[model samples]
Target: MTVDPSLSEEIIARAQSYPGIRAGIARLKDVLKAPSYQVVPEGEWSTSLSVLQESTVPEWPPEARSVLVLGLHHPKNDPRLDWWDRGNTNGNRRLMEISESLKQWLRKELHLGAYPLPYHVEWGGLFLKDAAVLAGLGIIGKSNLLLHPEWGPQIRLRSILIEGDLQPNEPIEGFFPCETCDVLCHKVCPQNAFSSGAYRRPSCIAQIDSNVANKVPGGEIDENGNSILVIKYCRACELACPAGK
Candidate 1:
C-alpha cells in the first residue's frame, strides 16, 4: 500500500491534542544511527538485563517504521512536575500516562501499533535525546540537554515506536542559544558536571548518589501500606538554563 502523504500531520495532531504536549515524527533507522548511539556501555549490569529482556524487543517489529516523540511543557514554575514521590517523579508518571493514552488513540482510530518505550537506553528503549533531535523537537545544547524552540530546555520527553512510516520532521536549524547566552547552566551545577565544557557523567552521577543517599521528607504510602522516602534528583543545570522561557 502506498504511504499516505498526510498521515504524519494527522498523527502529530492526535499527539498534540493532549494538553501541554507537542509531537514530532522520526524514522526509526535514523534514530538508531544518530550521534551518541554507542555511549550505552556494554557493562555487566546492562548487558545482563538486556539479555534477560531480549524477548521484549522482538527485532523492533518490521511495522515499527517510525517513532512518535512527544514533549511535555514542564514550566519552571511547576515544581510539582519535577518532584519525586517515590521511584517515579510526578512528571515521569504523567508522561507515561500520556504515552498510554496516545497508544490507545492510535490503536483504535488509526489502526496503528504504538509501543511505549522505557526511559533508559539500558532497557529495551531507544536513545530519546537522539530520537528527539531527529524528530525535529530540538537540538542538543552546550548543557547536553534537548533545547526546544519554544520551551527552551524546560521540556520533558517521552516517545512511542509507531508502526506507521510517517514522514519525519526536519531537524531544527538557525536556533542557537548556548552560542551567546551566559553559560550559567554550567555555573549552576552544584556538582560542576559541565565545569570543563563537557558533561562529566561520573560527577553528575555522584551528585545523584548523594541526593539518593540523603532522601528528603517527601514520600507516600507504598502498595503494601508502608511509607517510602522520596529522593529528588538534581536538575540544577536544567533549571538554570534560560533557553525557552
Candidate 2:
C-alpha cells in the first residue's frame, strides 16, 4: 500500500502553523532504535531519573504507525521561553497546548488516535532528540542537543503518535556544522560539562542545582499578581553555539 505524502505534509503544516513550532514524520521503529532511546543512562553522569511503572508509560498504540515530532524554537537568549513559573514555563505551556490542539484535530477531522506523549521519557514519553533526528528535523550536534537547520539546539522537542503508518522523510546527509567550528559550546560551559566528547551531566546538574538554590526573584508574576522567584537554568553552552544565531 502506497502511503500518501500529503497526509504527512498536511499534518506537519498544521503543526508548523503555530508560531515557533516545526513538525516532521519518522517511523516508530526507527525512533525506538535511535541513540538516546537505546541508552539506559546508568553511568556516573546519568541524567535519567527513576523510571515510572509500565502502566504509566505511554506505550505505542497498536494502530499508531507514524511519529510526528514537533520542535518549538526557544531562541537563544529568549528568557521568556525558559522562565519557570509554578510548574511550567511559557514555552512549555504553549507546546503543550499545541499538542492538545493537534490531538483534538486528529480525533475530530481524521477520526484517528493521536497520542501526544509527555516531554520526559521517564514519564511515559519518547526520547524526543532521537525522534526528531529520525523525523528529518536535524542532527544531534557536538553539544548533544538536536541542532536544527534553522533553529539549531535552541528548539524544544515533543512528539505525537499518529494512528496510521505514514511515509517517513529521509535524514539530512553530508551536513556537519559542528565539525568546522572551534566548538565553543564546550568551552563556554561554566561547569565544563562538555569537557570532552562526553558531557559530564553531574557537573551540569550541579550548576542547575545551584541556580535553583539561589532562585532569582521577580521574574514571573504569580496568579495573585505577586512577583515570584524563578530559576534560570544554565544555557551558556546552548547560547554560545553559533547555530541558530
Candidate 3:
C-alpha cells in the first residue's frame, strides 16, 4: 500500500496541471489528527453555519493512507469565484470537478483507489484547511484562513483520499506572514470576528447568516426573466491581507 516518491510526484504534478491549482500530499493519519479536531469534537452540532447540520464524524476508509490536497487560487478581483448559488460556490464546483477527474485517472491509469471528498464536513468531507496545513500547502493566518505563500488567504481548498501512502510534504519554515503587521484583516471584519484576539466562529457565522438573508439578484435570469438570487459571503478578512497580493 506504499507509493514511491516518483508516483507521488506524478500525482501532485497531475493535480497542479489544472488552472490556478496547487497540490501537496500528507499522511492520512496526520490530517486526521489535525489541530482543528482537538478544538471541536466530531459529530458535534455545527454552529458555524446558518443552517442546522450535525458535523459528520469522520469515518474514513481503513485503507486510506495519504491525502492529496488541492488548492485553487481565488484572487480578490474575481468575486464571482466565491459566489454561492443553490448550495455551492463556483470555486467549490470547480474543485469537485477536478477531484473527480483525478479520481478517475487514479483508478483507470494508475490502478490506485482514490476517493473524492465533499466540500462540507457535514456531508462527509474532511476539514480542508487543517488537511491543507498538514499537507504543507499553507499556514493558518490571523484571518483564520489557509494563507499560501503566493496567494495568501485568497485561496480555496479541496482534498482526495488515496489508498496508497505518499510522501508527505513538510510545512514551510520561518515563514510567518502575520507577524509585525497591522493586522488589517482583523480590523476589516464587519463582525469583528477576531476582536477577542482569536477567530470567533459564532461571530463569523453571524455575518454568514446575514449574507444568506440578504442575497442579491444574480446575473443569470430565470425562465420568467427575473434575475436569480445568489449569496455573496463576506471576505473582508481574507481580502484585506497584503501578504501575497
Top candidate when judged by lDDT against the true structure? 3
TM-score of every candidate: 0.87, 0.89, 0.91
Q: After superposition, how far is residue 153 of candidate 2 from its true place, in Å?
A: 1.1
lDDT of candidate 2?
0.80
Which residue runs of candidate 3 sit more than 4 Å off their true CA positions?
1-3, 41-59
lDDT of 3 by residue, 1-245 (tens): 45478988999999999999999999888877888778764232343433322233266787878889999999988889899876678898899889989999999999988888766776767789999998888899988899899999899998889886788888877768899679999999999888888898878888998898899987999899999999999999988898774
lDDT tens readout by residue for model 2, 173-206: 7768898889989888888887766687778878
The sequence of per-residue lDDT tens digits that candidate 1 reaches over residues 45-104 is 222443222224435677888999999888888766876564566787788888889889
Backbone clashes for every candidate come to 1, 0, 0
Each prediction's whole-model lDDT (CA):
0.81, 0.80, 0.84
* Clashes in predicted model 2: 0
Candidate 1 regions with alpha-carbon error over 4 angstroms: 40-59, 219-228
